[model samples]
Target: MGRMSDEPARWTRATVYPDMWVDPADDPRDGASPDGELATLLDFLSGYRMTLRMKCEGLDAEQLARRSVPPSTMSLLGLLRHLAEAERDWFNWISDDDPLPKLYGERDGDFDGAVGEQAAVDAAYADLEREQAATDAALAEHPDLGERLRKDGIAVRELMVHRIEEYARHCGHADLLRECIDGRVGQ
Candidate 1:
């Protein structure tokens, strides 16, 4: 059973993913090397992605599909599915220029995979894991983080800082969405 609603609030705040939360990396002032900013960013992204996954850990199929906020079709499961597509879109299509077609049926239904049942949820997560792995491997293949990618004739870093930004932004969304779902917040 869940905690009694009538119980006095013993805790000042709830965390979105208490068990999954990680302390920030050592500050740059600790005499550590100033290099590896890309690596640091990537680590942060990986942590946040795991946090997003952890936030949905115990929810069932229906609970995962439940819209935590009103007037919004976004669900925790939907965010997961969307982020997965987003990862592929940026890394596979934009960064590595893979000619592979998109997943999740049609273009508009990327997030729709989050709906239906537990099987759908599992599949979405699996897709995300696979895509993330491939992307990571691709990133590893390129040692030059400063390599410029010609995107529409504009140069972009191959280090994936933009993808890190994307994950951070969406993780913020996930934090709020999870909070609305069960009053969970923090981290």
Candidate 2:
């Protein structure tokens, strides 16, 4: 057999000009140095959401919905839809407001029904933005992280951390998927 190739066993993120997301110093989301726990948590959550949005930026509908990975229904469009639903669900859980009816009734419907169409892509982004704004507004009404409002009695701190974790996890997925789509990687 021929000698093995000299490439590293694990891949490192590329830092080429086209692959560069933005200069670390130039990144606008670095303003997370808040003075309190709630501010810090909200800043991190918003940063991750912005990261996901950056991953989806500049892609067309078909690219956004491209199920480029086989056997995984995790297109960027689907992620947008899923996050929208998640925000809505959590907002309802933590507040006394009436939530909009389920966007996708089935468990995986958000990802499953994510068709590669401009309208669907637009709707998903719009829903995610609207739901996230509403959730933030609802959350702002409660000043204490320990406050419990919903039936499950989940504390605001727990709920906020969960939201941050959820977005962070999906952002990892989004980074990989975006790289697979166009060989673009970022810091």
Write candidate 2's Cα lDDT for 1-187 as tens digits.
8569533233233334434577666677976499999989989998999999988888888888877567889888899999999998988897666656887788999999889899999899899999999889888988799998777889989989999999999998888777777666755
| Candidate with best TM-score | 2
Predict model 1's lDDT versus the native.
0.65
- For each of the candidates, give the backbone clash count: 0, 0
Clashes of 2: 0
lDDT of 2 at 7: 30
- Model 1: CA > 4 A from native: 1-35, 94-98, 150-159
Write one digit per residue (lDDT tens) for candidate 1, span 44-131.
6766777787667666887677675566677878887887787777564436454566776686466555685978888888989988
Assess the local accuracy of residue 26 in candidate 1 as a C-alpha lDDT between 0 and 100: 24
The TM-score, computed over Cα atoms with residue i paired to residue i, of candidate 1 is: 0.73
Scored by CA lDDT, what does every candidate get?
Answer: 0.65, 0.83
Q: After aligning candidate 1 to the native by TM-score, how far in Å is the CA of 32 from where it should be?
A: 9.9
